[model samples]
Target: MFDPDEIRGMLISAAQQRMALTYSEVLHALGHRFTRPLMRQLCKVLDAIDEDGRAAGEPGLAVLVVRQSDGLPGQGWFVARSGSHADLPLDWEGTEARRYVEARQGEAFDYWATR
Candidate 1:
């Protein structure tokens, strides 16, 4: 019985710490079992957070979650602050996280410049 807010907090903490986490890692951290419905709910919550951040003009705080094709863990997520050059953890997988930030560079700049 994991709360969505708890998951959101975990993501924020991970971003602040400049780390990435897999779905399994998140589940283990919460002491929860793996279930498809829970996974779907997590994804939905992440999407809502992303939208909310964008609407608030603080879009860079959004975490990027990607489904991996490697089949080991199946999915992973990362939080990368805009303009940060901090190195991600060695265990962090996927180019999607980096791509996610790169994709939003212009929007982030625009938001900050207008603020």
Candidate 2:
């Protein structure tokens, strides 16, 4: 079974490196290939990570895991956003979404760098 904490660590490393990993890259790190089922499972873990981050006043770590096509999180990620991120645009493939993701990713990258 995939472990959420382990994936979280991977995301932390990416954040510190100030780089985004494609969904396939994330799964590959775990010795798996991209599949809808596995991707969904990863998304669930990402949601949990963001939920925990929210409680801790940290930026969303899932922002570091994105689609290679547009360098943005999948639609599932936008759908899962809540709390302070509830105001995100409904359109995921546009400039608004890009800026929102960049800012969130920057926060994680900057915050992780300080640790």
Candidate 3:
């Protein structure tokens, strides 16, 4: 089974490195689908991470964990018809979206930290 925690960790690592990965990879890692609410929540998480100044290295993993609790898009991971830059096969998809999430992931803390 795909573990969200593990996926979050990878994103966090990518954030710390300030490197970006494919959005499809992120979805694959989480075993999720591309849905509207999921996309919104993911965006919200990124916004929250930035607002909280957790968009930097190493510490943003907490944000990922918290945001992850919002849940995956669906049962299986999402598929992108074209490149990662394509519409996410959903709307609101962007080239930087994946990187943005990664940056936030690195600053995440324990789930309790969010509460």
Candidate 4:
């Protein structure tokens, strides 16, 4: 069984350390290498974490997990945003996308970096 809290704790630790982790880095932290199944399950757990955080009025933790090349969350994060991401552009590309992503990531860092 996947321990969501374990992953949550790792994300929190990353926030505490004030840094974003690549998907592979997160998997390695959990003692697993990169795999499609693990990545999917990890995204599911991260979505749940974001939901719980939203309920508690906290920044999304999943923003801290991102692509290694671009340092941006995967497409799932954008697609899952019902209306909470209205501020972001529709196309979700270029400087606008980078600013939006960095803002969200900054929220997570600022919220948890000192806590």
Candidate 5:
């Protein structure tokens, strides 16, 4: 059974490796089956990080992006921090960030496809 801290740690490790994981990828990494409740719990962990960042007046430890994928329910990208870097703007609306995230997503897709 995976706890929230374990999930969070996995996410951070992925980020350190410079990989942007989707909900499915995260579950796969943890050897868990996909389920609605599990997805919700993962989102809650991301949200908690966001809330903590807001309360502490800092940037979030991760960023979540909602993306459309036909076969996946609640498809999105979760990117965690790699290291010391500039914090995203507190008022971040994701318009500018999406470009980078999408590019990375494409790279991830290409990588797995080739493997």
Candidate 6:
């Protein structure tokens, strides 16, 4: 079983290594410490934080992140339109997106890093 402290430590370490961690990355960092449902909830909270840029406000988009067995966070970046207009295609290159995901995931755990 994963202790809360252990999970916290892992998150901190990941955050420092990657710079920031995405919502899904946070859950993935938790590893076996939390169940899938619990991770989902965490992801929701993380998204809320991301969207609001604060601790409150409705999410601008709904994204699903699948957990990988290798302990790395798998990202599926999906953006939804806030209005009736169609969603814009992501222009970020694959490598850049991957880097962004890793950095965000890193932020999820770094205690020293300010959100």
Q: Please name the candidate that would achieve the greatest TM-score relative to the true structure.
A: 2
Q: Evaluated with lDDT, which candidate comes out highest? A: 2
Summarize candidate 1's per-residue lDDT along 21-114 as a digit string, tens digits.
6666676677866577777666666666766675765754334333334412222333322224354333434565455444544344444444
How good is model 1 by TM-score?
0.52
lDDT (tens digit, per residue) of candidate 4 on 31-80: 89999899888899899999999999999999889988888888777777
CA lDDT for candidate 6: 0.42
Q: Provide the lDDT at 44 for model 3.
A: 49
What's the TM-score of each model vs. the native? 0.52, 0.94, 0.34, 0.90, 0.50, 0.35
lDDT of each: 0.52, 0.90, 0.41, 0.84, 0.50, 0.42
Deviation from native of the Cα of residue 21 in model 2, angstroms = 0.5
How well is each residue in 16-76 modelled by candidate 3, as lDDT tens digits?
5544454444655566775556654554454444334433322433233222423232211
Per-residue lDDT value at 10 in model 3? 69
Q: Say which prediction, candidate 2 or candidate 4, comes out ahead on TM-score.
A: 2
Query: To one decimal, what is the Cα RMSD in angstroms of model 5 from the true structure?
Result: 8.8
Clashes of 5: 0
Clashes of 1: 0
> Model 4 segments beyond 4 Å from truth?
none
Q: Which residue pairs clash in candidate 5?
A: none
Off by over 4 Å in 5: 53-58, 64-97, 100-115
lDDT of 6 by residue, 10-104 (tens): 44454545443444455556563546666656654544434553234322212223344423233323332223224333433355445544454
Q: For each candidate, C-alpha RMSD in Å? A: 9.3, 1.3, 11.8, 1.4, 8.8, 7.6
